[model samples]
Target chain A: MPHLPPLLAKPVDIAPLWLVERVARMIFSCVLKAHPDLFARLGDYRESRYCFSPSDLQLHFRVVPATQALSVSRGTPPPADAHIEGPIALLLGLLEGRCDADALFFSRDLSVSGDMEAMLALRNTLDDSAIDLPRVIGSFGGPFSPVVTGFARYIRTRVLEGRETAWN
Target chain B: MELICPAGTPAAFREALEAGADAVYCGFRDETNARNFPGLNFSREELRQSIALARRKNVQTFVALNTFMRAGDEALWYSAADDAVALGADALILADFGLMAYVAERYPQQRLHVSVQASASNPDAIRFLVETFNAKRVVLPRVLTVQDIARLTSQIDCEVEIFVFGGLCVMAEGRCSLSSYATGKSPNMNGVCSPASHVRYREEGGSLVSELGAYTINRFGSGEASGYPTLCKGRFDVAGAEGYTFEDPVSLDVIDEIDALRAAGVSALKIEGRQRGRAYVAEVVSVLKKALGATSAERAPLVSRLRTLSEGQRTTSGAYDKRWR
Candidate 1:
């Protein structure tokens, strides 16, 4: 229930889409590097595209699992085989496999469209990966590892305030 | 009645325990268990750790080896049973008669539970299993009405357990081949039904369509809540009526009938959804535990809190009411 930061609270379309897309791609690459087998377990759905829409930010992030590609956009939202819309925090909570996707979905805190089966495929794959975002981000740095990891953990704590994590 | 809960992973298992679960049931991360979904279930190491933890908390652990045995897969089922007993599982929930016989003969002192997959609806079948294998408990199939459950509980000699919440299988438990016919996999054989591997969803003309294997399962308009594509909950044409012939997409929630269930001699109330996450398990277990502690007049609202967690955001007592012919 925490209000988003002033910068992110602004209409996402007003931001430079290229810059955001570039930063998002870098993070996605880091995640894939940390867990190389992340999407391999998706089976057939690994060939599918998944769209993550942040209802609060009005932004869409379409990820192509086969190619390990991510694109950021607004308006029409890229065509994908599976799509989920929620607060940006909840979406990132899913990124680290911290929040339970089924719980949020059942509560109507989020909406999923397109291929539910494919989405489930993605969910199961993500759940087992045990991806910890703070560790993944911190591993990339030598001198600044502590600072970056600490900052990342702080952000995660704020983002997931009033929410239950995987540890319950 | 004791509250039994499902846990697909170690995390979910802990959540259930923390939420006041009397017993936590889980399966190995393989086809030996009915909920053999990918990225879920326990490793031998995980189950060992879970059992160690459960012992400290004095909570029982039930390991499900409920799937039917296949010709070449007998060893897997046998090995799973050995490991579960070795890890000190409080009980082994078994369905296959062959496996049951093997376990009964080999581990004579180990407690055995007749899995619902056995579909022992009648007293004769229940008594046969109890006499044959010395089964301690029988999880009644979800097809029976509350009245039938009460009558059967009275007639049977073993302890009775019934499904109180989560997914409802319209077909007779353990005997249906609908999922196999559609997806070439079944809960009894492969531990999956309408598996994600063979399922597809697409939007056509503003309606979302769900398909399993090659057949259409269900369709939802713009605002209608979508549902799991289990074949039993699908829409199909039957006798000139193109509608949901089997069941609507609603989870079975009979928590409000807990007092009645206790009166009928149900030893445990089982919650389904081994495929669900920790949050769902924690919430449902906590809510049910609270409802059990509440007075009869205070129980309905506790059950109402579970509405959001139910499938399709709706709830049903299912066959418990016996409202339909």
Candidate 2:
């Protein structure tokens, strides 16, 4: 058979990249809104301390590029208040509610470092964001892509049903 | 025949020792140990004093340096292992093969017990530890049935330690990535699972929703008991129906099965709450020590009493019966 043009050689797999960046932006927006002071100074640093605007809030977070995260930190650092490590997919997993933070912690899939104060701040901030499910899906452009929208709906429904793990 | 208990802090360690525990296990206040909770576990000085105190009572002390070693950062784990040995730890409960290799090579004289984080579920996995690292004991994961334990004990060369009480982890030990996937702190990495730091309780539609990180794991009505917001026991919605698909909120009460476990060749029975207060530890341990001699039928009432002390006032035999799933 004659070769098709490179553009049409294969249907683009924009799902992974699109999915990750979209969710990253959501997490970004939530964190920015949660701590505007920290976001204003985020700059391009590889590591940061995200001290909340008020309360006794403080956390040290390290942002490793997706590829380098595995090699940079093997496990959560007790000194780090929060961590954004792992491939972009893993972070996306959290934002999309496809992952459980408790399981991740047990499996060392997402490592954290630091004291409980930092831990408490990060947890409280993330809880307040509620960026998963309908909110995440609604934020995306275009009429809800059936595939993405379906996944979001499924997650929400399952979460409501008390079956947290996707595998189950 | 030792009763190994966890101690999240120096006070907890002293508490465990005073509570008739034959031995207490603790970790440094870092990733080196599995119970890496804040305001918990021991500092180096505290560990030293704790060990000395336990030694005075002829009680053994073990240090858990259980988490995996990051590439190029094996030194920290190694140093922790070495320090544990230096501080006169009776045994070092280890998980990582690389760390085990280091300890075997450097501190060959020091005893090594495999941490439950290794999740050696079968004879082959247990054999690997025995042959490779010469581990003296293996803390079996909580997923095994009593029959499974019998089969495993018949094949493995090492002593077997199993969880008898306290928090129930439904997932396969050391394998599930649920917690870190949510809030970025994990048991394997940070030594905590479904950590309290990440838990939030909010009132919604006249119900109390318990959230861990960004996910609502459970919701309770006025008459219902609210369980600790651990990810595994958290009730969630699946396929548009709500129920606990993972595990019910309950404490493991193997008190009734102690005789069966003993007959199956279990070498040790572990109580899970190192973060618990001295009063709770003393009460539970004292009761269990007494139950160790009682018949299984007689132990049933104690199990009921333990349920009253559980987070949601529920109790389970865990994987012992094999029908819970």
Top model by TM-score, which number? 1
Query: What does candidate 1's lDDT look like per residue over B191-290, in tens digits?
Result: 8988877777666886768788899998877667667788889899888988887898788988878888888889999999888877678788888888
lDDT of 2 by residue, A1-168 (tens): 112234532232222434444554565555445444431111223232432110011112234322112111112332333444432333444443344433333332333333334443333223223344444454463575566767767655543332123121
For A47-117, candidate 1 gives per-residue lDDT tens digits of: 88999988778679999898998999888888988888878888778776677676565445667767766
Model 2 scores a C-alpha lDDT of 0.65
lDDT of 2 by residue, B44-159 (tens): 88789989999999999989898888788778898898889999999999888989999998988889999889888899998988898889999988999999999999998989
Question: Which residue window of length 10 is worst by lDDT in model 2 chain B?
Answer: B274-283
lDDT of candidates 1 onward, in order: 0.84, 0.65
In model 2, which regions exceed 4 Å deviation? Answer: A1-168
Whose lDDT is greatest here?
1
For every model in order, the TM-score on chain A comes to 0.90, 0.38
**Total clashes in model 1, counting residue pairs 3 or more apart in sequence or in different chains:** 0
